[model samples]
Target: MLNKKKELYVAVAVGLIALGGAAVFASQSSSGDNAAKDKKPPASLTSVTISDQQATHIEVVPVKTYDFVEQNEAVGYIDFNQDATVQVFTPYQGRIRQVFVKAGDDVRKGQALFSVDSPDLVTAESTLISTAGLTKLTTAALERAKKMLETQTAAQKDVDQATADQQTADANFRAARDAVRIFGKSDADIDRLLQTRKVDGELTVNSPLTGKVTARNAAPGLLTQPGNAPAPVTVSDLSTVWMVASVSETDLPRMKMGQSVSVAVMAYPGKIFQGKVNNIGIAIDPATHRVGVRSEIKDPEHLLHPQMLATYRIRVADPVQSAAAPLNALVREGDGTMTAYVTKDGRTFTRRAVQTGLEQEGNRQILSGLQPGEKIAADGAIFLSNMLSLQSR
Candidate 1:
């Protein structure tokens, strides 16, 4: 009875174990099927859809006809015309007593700038005084000798000797008077020195031309001498200014005298100044391989100055037919090349390499690789480029 009871219990335990194992295997199989189904790519991500309006957000431009002026670009500098610059130099050795003018001062012609204490001027004055005194003596002696000769109270040789002495004295007086004049002394001052026998050490320095003082090299009490460094003053007339441009030889033929040009300085951006080509060089510089072109600008208000850097654009007289597009149409490729997209149809964009010209009046000129009346991608070019890149990938 006990063995039969144990056998029944074992059978029940085996049956329960078999059922539990079967249920566990079935659950794992169902989980594997679910995982396999989930492994497939999701339906929502299988494709990308973009609306026509969203695609159109990539802005576009149209090629249009415009009148483009051909221009030659060159870097240039502002300079005083050679005819307008004057270098003032000392005429003699002297000590500067006072300087009345500073650099950048506007002065008129013959305006006194400073005074000099000059020993040469004193010597000139003394010589003039001595010569004038001798002149009076010689004149009296000549008159007496002439009278004696007329009255037959003197010999012919005596009258001739007295006349020769008078002439020598007269020549000496004239030479001394001229010497004083050459020393920059006025005639009235020379006469005063002769009458008073007193020397005036003050020598006035005057401007030779009507212009502004551009340089000051001497100070009060400094010695000014000839053959030394230049005088303390430099003057220039700024009413008319010159712009010097170095143009390539290839562009030389396009330039002509009296042609209108434009100039801009970095100091004043977006402000263009107008000028006329006044001169052109016949020869090219061997080192730079460029020709010098000079333009003259009228500055009545004296706004322009010397040595300022400027950019010049010379207008060529050639008739130009140009194609233009909006600024947004420009695309920079990875290799530093520029490209633009032309829409063959309203929906398709074709990339084209374009050569660009000068940008003027907010529009850029298309030199080549584009036709007028074509539609171009004016904005969101980067998005278009990325799309193309993705398509290629």
Candidate 2:
């Protein structure tokens, strides 16, 4: 019975050893499978190739490092520099007797714009003439009184009264003359009115500065007055104009006074207007959350007109250091990854995913996934991508 029991125990120990060996083998097999699944495929294994004869048709260049500006684009419009614009009004109530200029006319300073028949001018001129006559009469009387006193034929009281009258007449004459001058009449015209004794009620309105007439309300026989509806005319100096732009809240941080800007107008395509930021608004619009930005552009050629649609690009940052690639070298893949083809030898070109930065002019900035000296397809990268796609299919 003792020998049979020992035999059973030996059989059970052998079975347990076999089971342990089998479990170790299965665990080793599973770990090997997982490592194979996690391994990434080599890019050279799937790289695209072309013959030397085909390579002559395509151009390749080394990736370059340079400084690039990050640009922010905004829509804007050409506007008048309010400081250089003027809305002219007549100085007195009157009827427009004649119109000498029209809208769109270039006018010089002191150029006659229109003439008005003013009753106020008539009243002022009449007072001036009366005062001139009275002053002349008082002066003659004063001279006679002085001569009589010198010969001891008149009392001192008589001379003193005459001198007082003369002084009073002079004060009245100056007041009347100034009133006529206030009605847009020059001092010389006032003198002529007094000298010729002519009562001229015609008042002429003149341009206050050199500019182009942008609006006109003057017409023959129209009743007009100072501060009436629509000024007599609007003149604007277009030598330097304002470009008003609304900047998004996201881009407001990029704007500052004196920042350089480039403007393009639909009126003259291909012509770029240069300007600088003159002002930035303190208030942000509630609805759009955009701040107002005003840039002053020199339009000495008068090529830009007010209210014209314009596009603005602002350079907000100093040029940044980055790897630059030709725009033609970049290819956007179906997976939305930006890629470029790189090659160590001319025959085998591998696909490399590159992170892109600012794209301006024709140059694109490569933020990552490319070295400075790596060779890339400069002109025909898209064609290579297409060929690779066909082969994969």
> Which structure among the candidates has the greatest TM-score?
2
Please write out the lDDT profile of model 2 over residues 1-393, one tens digit for every residue: 999999999999999999999999999999999999999754433468998888986689999887887778999899999999988888999999989999999999999999999999999999999999999999999999999999999999999999999999999999998888888788888878888999988899999999999899889899898888798888899899999989999988878889999899988877889999999999999999999999999899999988999998988888898889999899998889999999988778899999998886667889899989999997878888988987776
Tens digit of lDDT per residue, candidate 1, span 201-264? 7888788899999889879899988767676788888888999989999888888899988888
Give model 1's TM-score versus the native structure: 0.63
- Where does model 1 exceed 4 Å of error? 1-69, 257-259, 278-287, 318-393
Each prediction's whole-model lDDT (CA): 0.82, 0.90
Pairs of colliding residues, candidate 1: 60-378
| 343 Cα displacement, candidate 2 (Å) | 8.1
RMSD of each: 9.6, 9.8
Assess candidate 2 and give its TM-score to the true structure. Answer: 0.75
TM-score of each: 0.63, 0.75
Q: At residue 282, what lDDT does model 2 achieve? A: 93
